[model samples]
Target chain A: MRNMAKGSFKVQVLQAREGAIVASVNRLLAEKGYDAMTVDEVAADVGIAKASLYKHFTSKEELAAAAMIRLLDHALAFLATLEAQPKATALERLKAVARWTLQVQLAGEMPALPAQNSTLRAALAANKTYLDRLMLVSDKLGEWITAGQKASQLNRKLPPELILYTLFARACDPVLSLLKAGGKYSDEQIVDLLLTTCFDGLCGHAKLRLA
Target chain B: MRNMAKGSFKVQVLQAREGAIVASVNRLLAEKGYDAMTVDEVAADVGIAKASLYKHFTSKEELAAAAMIRLLDHALAFLATLEAQPKATALERLKAVARWTLQVQLAGEMPALPAQNSTLRAALAANKTYLDRLMLVSDKLGEWITAGQKASQLNRKLPPELILYTLFARACDPVLSLLKAGGKYSDEQIVDLLLTTCFDGLCGHAKLRLA
Candidate 1:
């Protein structure tokens, strides 16, 4: 009984340590970006030695992949929560996702890393686990796009892939953080403005009337 | 008379060599990006020894800066050409610039380089030659935006900076090339669709006229 209890305690402690390392990595990636981040820095941030970080993930590539996978999981989980909400329209869900994305970015919880690192891009491409989750989220959003189009909530002429890319663009939408940090507008005001600019079109009623 | 002719010929040759170096750097920066591009490859591409390349630009940063300054010059020059054209509306001139930018990117001439290099960013920020041209273009566009709003062609609620950034966003707009290259849409079709998307809202009828 004693041995079992000791084993259980060890497992829990290992899980806690792993979680800590991932959290630290996410924070670093958000703050400094992937190209500038190093394994030793993540290890040091987590109060673990470099070797111990290697024990968790053998390489910086793997560490970054793991961090990205965790984010994907969070995204999927957010979608699930939205799904559980009763009678949400496809457009509502998309706005929810966009809102959540903005909130994450504002909180600095997002790994707002650049997509310029070839090695990291390759790692992500080869990552079946990450790739699978990414594709799944993609499909979910694609469904909304199709549904919205059919319901005439979306422009039928506009391609779904284009919509997807625009949403992805919002992640790095420098305008969000720029406006928030500029202190010219409140956070809610900024979010509302972006949502309007993104969805309802930037043209005033006169231009809209022509279309 | 012969010696004077030879000296003038030598000066022309030197100018050509500098132009070749700048062109090669731009190509490499586009392909491998700034972080991965090397001086050795640039020297080889320019058909010059590494020493010769260094003689022209003492460091890689200087070489990159020269390439960027050259691009800014191209943009300013294009704006100048547009200014010479009479009877063009603000929107018409804006669209002309947008088309020219897209054409440059399609021809593989536009430098949509990612912002990964802090040193390059610092250099650009301090670069009076580049900043002067950038600000001139920006101020000119800002005037058009204000006029566009006053003329009821633009959304007055949206700030001028947002409009300016939206147009600038096209230079780096990944969707334009990605969808075109995806083979789903022809270049002409892609450009038209993107142009429409930019000026008008995505909603074909606008203002939630889903029916």
Candidate 2:
């Protein structure tokens, strides 16, 4: 009984430490961006030695992958919640994802990695757990896109994947930050404008000749 | 007479060397990104010593600035050519810019630098020459946007700057390369899809509600 209790305590401590490390790395990455944030800084923030940090993740690339995996998990969870709400339409779901992603950025929870690293790209590509959640979310969004197009709620000419990339680009788009930094619009106003631009035709009500 | 000719020849040789250094740096920067590319490698690629390379641009930052300045100059010239065309509408002008930009990228003439620099935000901001040209092009684009909105050609509900950024993002958007690299679409098809997404409502022919 004593040994079991001791093992349980050890497991809890390990889990707590791992959680702290993930949170610390995320904060550092968001603040300093991927290129500037070092593993030692992450370890220091987590109150662990660099060696302990290494024991958890082999390199900075892996740590970034883990952080992204967490983000994907959160996104999946958000999608599940939205799915459970039967009142939501397909366009509503996509808008919800965009709004949540913008909110995350505003809340300082967004990752700042530039997505330009070859090694990091390889790691993310090979990360099955992350890829699975990404695909699940992607597939859900893809269906919504197709449904919207069929219903004439979305554009039919554009491919679903192109639409997906445009939506994904919203998360890391520099314009959001630029607008925020300029203090030109309140957060609510910015989100509203962006949402309008994303779904509704930016052309308002104009009719153009079809070639 | 011989001395004057020799002096002019020397000037031409120096100009050629400077252009070569810039090209070498641009190539290496695109291949390895900003942080990974070394000045020595650039020098080696140009068949010159590191000291000789520094004679053209004092530092890596300066070399990069020169490259970016040249790119901006190219953009300005392209806009000039478009403006000179008598029958160009605002949409036609915008499309002309996009087409030229893609052609430049396809030709391997565009410098893929600003995305990787942490200091670029401040560096470019402090750079008077860059700022002047940037603002000039920005103003030119802004006028077109307002004209577009006024002509009932663009969606007035959306901000002009946002539209401008969206267009700029197209030049460097990774999606074009990704789709092309996937072997799924020809370069022409990819560019056409992107241009369509940019101008026409991605939502197809459906009437859009902005409110």
Candidate 3:
């Protein structure tokens, strides 16, 4: 029993260390981006030896994938909270998800991965954990999107894939950072303005107001 | 007279070579981004020795800045064409510019720069030619945005800076590439769909149509 208890404690410590490493990778990736971030910097940020980090994750690509997986996990948790809100419409839930993404990006927690990095793309594709979480999130969001469309909340003329990609694209939208840098608006205001432009569009709302 | 002719011919050749170098840099920056792109690759792509390339532009950042300047020049030229029309509304002209930016990006002519790179940002800031063209384009676009607002063609509630950044953001929007990658839509269809979303928005148009 004592040996089992000691083994459990060791596992918990290892998990905690791995979590710390992933968190550091997430922050560094968010700050410098994947191309500028290095494994040495990540190790330094985590206050661990490079060899120790290597033991936890084999490569920078793996570190990135781990960060992405963690992000997806957080996203799934957020989705669960939205799912529990029984009064929210399908479109409302999707907007909430988008709002959450923008808020996270504003808070400097979203890892800014390049959409066109071949090596990193390959690594993400090969990562089972990352792929699974991504698919799971997509599936959940997909359900809400179709529901939104059926309820005539989202545009039925647009394909579901387009809507899905647009939502995913919001996580790294440069407009958030640009507006944030402008310093004229609060974080809530930034998200609200972007959310307004995003769903209602720049001209659409104006036209509607006129009509 | 003979010496003058020879000098003119030499100048034309040098101009052509510099243009070729900037073109290669633009393509490399689009394909590999700024961080992954290297001087060696740019020189190799341009079919010049690294030393010869450096003789024209002193640094990689200069090459990027030159490409950006060229792009701005092209934009200014396009805006001039729109101005010549004189029949298009400010909103229509703005939409045309957004479409052109998306088309350039889809054609892989857009140079993708890191928004947070201090060294490159410093170099660009120091570049008088780049800054001048950027301001020229912004001034032209700013006119249209305000006109659109005054004419009630754009959302008055949103700031002009938000509209300006939103249009600029469309150049690097991931949704354009994602839809392109899906291979289900033609370039025109992709541009049209995105333009629809940009102006009319997802929720607003569907609601308008339903109403």
Candidate 4:
């Protein structure tokens, strides 16, 4: 019984260390982005040696994947809570997801990965946990989008994937950072303004014509 | 007279080489983004030795700034053309600028800079030519924005700078490339779809509420 107890304690300690490593990685990715972030920085941030970090994550791509997985997991949990709230319209649910992403970004937790990095893309694609969680989030958002369209809350003509990419783009939007850097608006105000632009656009009932 | 003619020929050759270098930098910046791009790749792309490239631009940041200055010069020229248009409304002129940026991006001539890079920002901030040209472009766009708002052609409640930033953000919008990658739409179709999303938004006269 004592041996089993000691083994369980060892596992618990290992899990806690792993969690700390991932958290440090998440912050580094947010601050420096994937390309600028080094494994050395991640190790130092976690108060561990580089060798030990390698024991947990083999490469910079793996570290990024771990960070993204944690973020997606949080997103999944947020979606579940939204799902639990009965009687909310699909548009409201979608907006909630948008707002949540903005809040996370404002809190400096969003990892801004470059979209065109092939090796990073390969790493993410190979990561079952990351891909699965991302698909879950995408699928949930897709459902809300379709329902909103059917109900005339969203523009029925816009493709669902376009809408999805727009919302995803918002999570890393330079406007939020620009507004923040300007020191002109509170976080809440910035969120409200960007949210409006994301949904209502800048035209505001004006008829749009090609240039 | 012979010596003067030879000097003029040398100057023209140097200018042509510099222009080629800047064009290569612009394309690489578009494809790989600023962080993932390296001086080695740039030198290789331009078919010049690293030392020879350094004779033209001192650092990677300078290379990026040179590309940006070139881009802004083109923007200024485009703005001049738009300004010369006899009867285009402020809204139409603004849309013309939007469409022009989208076209440049589609043509892979847009240099995608990282908004958060302090060194690059410092380089740009210190570049009088770049700053002057950028200011000219922004001031022109700002005038159109206020005019549009005043005429009630745009959302009156949204700030002019907000509108300016929104339009600027669309130049680098990931949605364009995402749609292009999907292969379901022609380039014209993709631009039109994105143009609608940029102006009409996804809501399409639908009201938005916070989640």
**Model number with the top DockQ:** 3
Clashes of 4: 0
Q: Identify the superior model by DockQ, candidate 3 or candidate 4.
A: 3
- Docking band of candidate 2: acceptable
Question: Which pairs, if any, clash in model 2?
Answer: A154-B203, A155-B202, A155-B203, A155-B204, A202-B155
Q: Rank the candidates by lDDT, best first.
A: 3, 4, 1, 2
Cα distance off (Å), candidate 1, residue A157: 0.5
Output the better candidate (2/3) by DockQ: 3
What's the lDDT for residue A153 in model 1? 74
- lDDT score, candidate 4, position A37: 81
* Predicted structure with the largest TM-score when compared to the true one: 3
Pairs that clash in candidate 4: none
DockQ of each: 0.38, 0.40, 0.60, 0.48
The models' CA-based lDDT, in order, is 0.76, 0.75, 0.90, 0.87
Question: TM-scores for chain A, candidates in order?
Answer: 0.90, 0.90, 0.94, 0.93
Using lDDT, give the best candidate's number: 3
Listed for every candidate in order, the interface RMSD values in angstroms are: 4.4, 4.9, 3.1, 4.9
Q: State which candidate, 1 or 2, has the greater TM-score.
A: 2
Writing each residue's lDDT as its tens digit, candidate 2 over A1-211 gives: 5547457777888878887887777777767778878887888788878998888888888898888878888988998899899988887888888899888877778777764577778988898888898898889889888987787777776767878887777677666776677787888877776666556545545322211
lDDT: the better of candidates 2 and 3: 3
Q: Model 1: clashing residue pairs?
A: none
